[model samples]
Target: MEPSTGKKKTERNWGDKFLNIVEKTGNKLPHPATLFCIFAVAVLLLSAGLAALDVSAEHPDPDIDEKVKVVNLLSKEGIRDILTKAVDNFTGFAPLGVVLVAMLGVGVAERSGLISAFLKKIVMGAPDMLITAVVVFAGIMSSMASDAGYVVLVPLGAVIFLSKGRHPIAGLAAAFAGVSGGFSSNLIITMIDPMLGGFTQESAQMMDSAYTVTPAANLFFMMASTVLITVVGVLVTEKVVEPRLGSYTGSYKQDLDSLKPKENKSLKIALFALIAYVIVVALMTVPETAILRTDEGALLADHESPFIGAMIPLIALSFFIPGLAYGISVGDVKKDKTVVKYMEDTMSTMGGYIVLAFVAAQFVAYFEWSNIGFILAINGAEFLQAINLTGIPLILAFILVSGFINIFVGSASAKWAIMAPVFVPMLMNMGYSPEVAQLAYRIGDSTTNIISPLMPYFAIIVAFAQKYDKNIGIGTLISTMLPYSIAFMIAWMIMLSAWLLLGLPIGPEAPIYY
Candidate 1:
């Protein structure tokens, strides 16, 4: 029999062929925002179906005749309330406010050419084998600054890799793994600390009337997790990603001309100024009587501690001071007008981000107002509890559930807002601590972030890959990263399970139970 014209099979490797199929399909796929709207409709339909069938559950309602009420999406008041809340929620979200404020300083750093110069110096000096490791390390560190890893380090990884005659895509993957995959784990506390802590507190309160989940609840565990992820990320980049890429020999070349060195005198002055700023900041954060600390000596745990609550502003200044010095030295900021321009320019880049955030905020608010998330969470928790699974099996199941949810909804805090209320209380009822539940959620959230299209930066990654291979698409990127995602998932779960069995503290004064 002759082969059909519609389906002529070639002798290509299955992996390569699979990638080809994905690229073709992705090319034909609708735009991401359109896809999101489609999914939102589907969610609406599903909610509608549940309402019609009266399959939804509700918690105690003091004023109502029935404790459990059917979710009515058709109700005009309900829909109006949801839309109103969504709009209000997006505009009022605190993180957006924080980012905007911090960017004023960061903009100055980036514009002064300080950030680029510093990165170039580091890249030039780093060893060959250590290049991938350093990119990953920096990605982990950049988490302290929030979203800078996505905007700065991930693209820089591609640039660095291309410069070194390695596959740029592989470099991007390694950095993405560190930035998004290791999002929850970091050496230093970040804005995420307080965000997650807020969610944890909400979850814990379901069981305890006066419960509190500290911002540093998982600090120790996160510190260790940072080391674990870095080791794994570096190994995977070298062993798996590099070997698969097989000596790039591609036509792409680095634009070293873009990286002009600063004048000697300016460089020297900036270096001194940077040193002075760092010493001052360190002194404020270090001693028992440091100004950044509370009277009791705690840095962030106390409300009165400057270092604790003012970390974001401090971060902004860290970048701004060095950037200002560098800019002044390099004559990039010859006038006060130039300095203000740098700050303004930095804020401009955030325009697209703000739009995305607005949409995401609405979606999150709508989800919360509908009460559908809470209902689903409670039911899901009950089902999991009924399975009677324990230890590794239970933890693994939670990881899988988290990974699955990540594909549809990318926000960690939003997902936790829904999941924590149910899982934390259920687990606590089953003798697991709120810390353990939160840790499990973190593991799941982190491991799958790299591969999920729902992730806000997934599109950015696809764009990065296309710069290397025009034929590349979402599938190509996902396939390349599947190995790292799988490896990290298994390894992270095992690490968490072992930690749980040992009864060790996840962080300082952070216990695994009520």
Candidate 2:
């Protein structure tokens, strides 16, 4: 039975008030790029102020006698250095080229209809009894192709549920939960992995100059999380969300279109091409003397290894080969020019990120060059150490901070650019690996996405939900997704705690402790 009307009303009032506060505060913040610019300027001023005071910290390494001190950035020499290094900083930013290269191939796959058709085939072909689980699983896996799930699978989810004589909103919630709430968990690598890993590596170099973090640093944990999120998402949807949503009583009822013969054939060709490409890559990495292996014959000995360094391009080719194959067979690629045009379209969408990257690069450069990041990290680590908060509790606290910050910052890369220089180095000083810190941040970031108003695609989700139930509002959507967000955070934390206690590697050649 439903809760008493008065009790429900009272609880909703409190939740709505808090969400309103968050929305208003988030709206008051500047655009991310602008925010970075402000931060850069603030860093310059802070550096000058701190330098005047001779603010410094003892190096964390006792063997090092020199203290890391803030450098004044408000002088003529500072301006000259800034002007000279600006372009180099933007160009040298680690995440830039890799994300672009990865997205190029992903764009071809998406534009060729390969990714879209694959999503449809999985969701539409599922048994009636297992449709919810399949939809959620497909949503989690869709990140392998980037943001296409938000555009393709979410609406299709509602349609799939409506056709099954169930509440369409329930299916929308389930799909959204899996896609956004489970965004950090994928069986395969996603663009965010490389992007965030690059940022983490840059931050780690503040303390450990030779340290490197690879895109696969958190792969094993993420793969397990895929199943964890899927199971938890399924349970929440069936037992909590769907039951609460009840049966479909809306005017909208649409049948999901089955995959056409030509698309199905194209998908088969694409899968074959993908499999063939994987085999080729495997051959190049599986043998001791293979071209992609390290000098010592290990395929993935370190980030400097040929296989590890080449992963971004390898991932690109994986998608490019299959996408080209499918597009040709499906007539999407009439000629070579068509493929180039598709790639061009993808680059055009990245104009904003490119702009953001420029300022973000400068901010990171300023923060590092001024020695503020190292000093703060040393002092922060010492403070945490003094409080005896060095292990699981510290990690949990960081996750909570990340999740709270995610509610206001829509872009994961942008947020991480600002946060990693602080948290990654701080955790490193505490004897934790950058991989562990990155994983914790990701867990916090992904779990809050479904309920966060700042997410770019949330409006689209709301519009889709409105098609099924006109009575639905922002409050209703948040209420629906809140369960998924909370459940995902709790379950993910439990898994992370267990993994830490067991001292298992989070990924290939990645240790939990530095």
Candidate 3:
């Protein structure tokens, strides 16, 4: 389903030839849900075979001095375990609840026309000189709201660019690149920061009991990367992607009259509500005696802080209050029942994701139970250690490996859980800090996300693209995004190399050396 951009097939170059192969091969695969089902079954069979051969690894943790064996999921006991745990697996799937809850609030905003109005503000009100950077930076910063970026910004970016008489696909590419490719680069601390930091801490303590990885471990590096990604996004969009895309011929047009006086009033109400909400949140967390602070009088940045755990609900309320305000002002939500209806409608759209989540939950559970990821990580780390590689070259090589593995495993935390226990200690032994190792892993994990089929948001982005160009397919999206992916990897690698040479600290206490 390659898009017919009217370019002759004869003009296709080597990169095009390569991406066509990638897309076609990817398209030949089953749907993500079915693929996860296959992976679950594969994990079961592989576990049984490995258990038969008694394959295992020596657990890396000094406290847990035991060999880790692959658990056989084919046995009667294993079957019973699977049957009983299936429901819990789906319910406990990390992204499932977060996405569903967030969408509930976003649904209200969208239905009440608040979202559209806000997007128009960005599109129409932003200075033309700063629009590209603003869009890219906003996309990067959207990590704070969890998956909201994928749900909102990607589509908005296309709409914004289309309104400006540019290729909408390029806008989509730029936004997707920033949202996913720059996922690890944010000026603010996000849920993933403490989440991955916890993994790094656990792995680090396996080697040194007192070692800890704070939420801010990669803060400085990621802050710098925010700017780097923005610059790269602009460069890739303007210099390569847009020029190749040429003019958009799609029928989608901006509704110039959509923002009525009533809508504008609603928008104003929403904006005021949002400002008030921010003020309240700041007061609750910014002061020494802040209610949102930890028992130790610490702010939201602590690993054990409730604030991070409360992000989903906070995000939901943040959207909900403003959305509710707008809805009331616009008279679209006359009653509480209308808000519930909007929420229901949003859930209705998640049917595909629910199915995918179930299967993916099973796959992830089976992979964990079978101990496959751990064994792979342990053995992979040992192989790298045996080679005795050191310095920036080793870190660069590790980044490439992490990026390659990310194509198959979608979750950043999941991959880091497997890799951290292995690489953190391995790098620590080489006199590199856990923070440095985590930073490198983050770069690899994020840069490859735009190109990975396993990423949960990939299909959603494709659907958004299809809204404009019906002929667009996985191939078209991948081809359009490949440049950004390549550009991010190169730019990030160079930045990391320079940072290392300069002996820069990544965060408050995060140094490059162990």
Query: Per-candidate TM vs. native?
Result: 0.76, 0.64, 0.87
**1-514 in candidate 1: lDDT tens per residue?**
2211122223246654664565457656654445445545655666667677777554422233443434565478767766666667766755566566667777788778776566566666568678887888888877775665765567668878877667787788889889875576888776567777777777777778687778778888889988888889999888776665655544565644334545445556667877898899889989889988878886655334577567667767877887888888787788999988888887776664576566545555555445566565546555677788876588678878887777656678777876777678777887777877888888888888887765766655665565566555566677667767888898888888788778889987888655
Worst 10 residues of 2 by lDDT: 1-10
Candidate 3 lDDT over 322-435, as tens digits, reads 999999998888888999999999899788678877887888788788987777766766776777789998898898888877876777887888788889988898889999
- Colliding residue pairs in candidate 3: none
Please tell me which predicted candidate would have the highest TM-score against the true structure.
3
Writing each residue's lDDT as its tens digit, candidate 2 over 207-267 gives: 8999999889999999999999999999988877776555565667554467899999999
Model 3, position 463, has a per-residue lDDT of 63
Off by over 4 Å in 2: 1-13, 125-256, 388-514
CA lDDT, candidate 1, residue 408: 59
Best by lDDT: 3
Candidate 2 local distance difference test against the native: 0.77
